[model samples]
Target: MNLIFIDSIWFTFMLLPFLIFIARIADVTLDTLRIVFITKGNKIIAPILGFFQILIWLVAITRIMKDLDNITYYLAYAGGFATGNYIGLILEEKFALGIQMIRIVTQKDASSLISNLYEKGLHSTSVEAKSNQGKVHVIYLIVQRKMIQNIISLTNQYNPNAFYSIEDIRSVDVQSERINTKQKKYRHVGSEK
Candidate 1:
C-alpha cells in the first residue's frame, strides 16, 4: 500500500508540470490572436478570444500558486510562453485576415499594368501625376491581404522598378448593390422551384 501511494505521488508530481506547460501555451496563443483581432477592429471575435485567454491564464496561475516551490513548473511555464508567441505569429500569417491598400508609382508607362489588373478582376484607379523626374503614373488598389502576393507578381512583371507601398486598411464600405443582386438571384431561383 505504501509503495502504491509513493508511485501515485511521483506520477502526479511529474504530470503537473507537463499539464501546466500545455495550458500556458494555449492561453498565450489565444492572447496573441486576441491582440491581432483587436487591432483589426474585430469587435465580436476579439472579446470572445479575450474571455477564453483570461480564463485559461487564471487556471494556470492557480496551479503555480498551489506549488510555489516547484522549479520545474516555473520553467515549463516560461518555456510555454516563448513557444506560444512563435506559434501565434505563424498562425496569424497563415490566416491573413484583413485588407490592404497598395499604392504603386511607376515612371514607366502604366497602361499595361492597369489593363492587366482589370483583366484579373482587380479594380484600381490610375492618376497622371508629375514628379521631379518627370511624369509618373500612380495606381491605387485595395485588395484582400492574401492577394498582395499576386499583385506584387503582376507589378514585377509589368514594371520591375515600380515604387509600391502597402498599408493596412481597418475597414471598407462595400457597395450594397452587389449584395442585393446576389439576394435577388437567390430569390428568383427559389421562386422557380
Candidate 2:
C-alpha cells in the first residue's frame, strides 16, 4: 500500500494538481496584497510580498510546464487564480490598510452630522457653499479605511439625503490639525495570521 501511494498515477494526477492549485492560490493572493500595498504607498511591505508572489508563481508554472498535456493541472491553475482574486480581496478588506477621504454634501443643516462625527472622536471640516440649490454644506473627513462604514452609517443616520464620495488618500500631512495623532500598529494583522 505504501509503494502504491508513493509511486502511482494517483499521486501524479491527484496530489500534483492539488499542490499546484494551493500554490497558485498563495502566490496570486500575495500578488493582490502587493498591488494594494503599492497603491497605499507602502514601500517596504509591497516589495516583500512581491518577492514571495513571484517566487511561488515560478514554482507553480514550472510544474505545469512539466505536464502541459494534463487537463487537470490547467483546471487547477485557472480555478486557483479565480479563487485567489476573491480571497485576496477579502483579506485586503480585513487588513484595511490605509487612509480614506470622505466628502459629504448635504442640503440639510449639517450641525447634527458634524456633532455626531465629533462625538465619535472624528474630526471634520464643514464649509457652507452656494450651489444651484441655493445653499449646501460640504463636509470632509479623513479617517482610517476601517472606519469608513461606521462614518457612512453616521452620515446616513444624521443626514439621510447627503451625497458622499470616498477616495483613497495616497498621502497626508500627519502633523496637520484634524488628523489623528494616535499611532496604529498595523503589523498585528499580518503577524496574527
Assess every candidate by TM-score. 0.84, 0.89
Query: For candidate 1, lDDT tens digit of each residue in 93-118?
Result: 98887877899999999998887776
Off by over 4 Å in 1: 1-13, 176-193
lDDT of each: 0.80, 0.85
Q: Write the per-residue lDDT of candidate 2 for residues 1-193, one digit (tens) a residue.
A: 4987856888878998899999999998999999999998999999999999999999999999987998999999999999999999999999888888999999999998787676556788999999898799999988888877877777887778889999999989988868742324222211331
Each model's RMSD to truth, in Å? 6.9, 5.5
Best lDDT among the predictions, by candidate number = 2
Clashing pairs in 1: none
| C-alpha positional error of residue 90 in candidate 2 after TM-score superposition, expressed in Å | 0.9
Per-residue lDDT for 190 in model 2?
14
Model 2, which residues run further than 4 Å from truth?
A: 1-6, 181-193
**Lowest-lDDT window of 10 residues in candidate 2?**
184-193
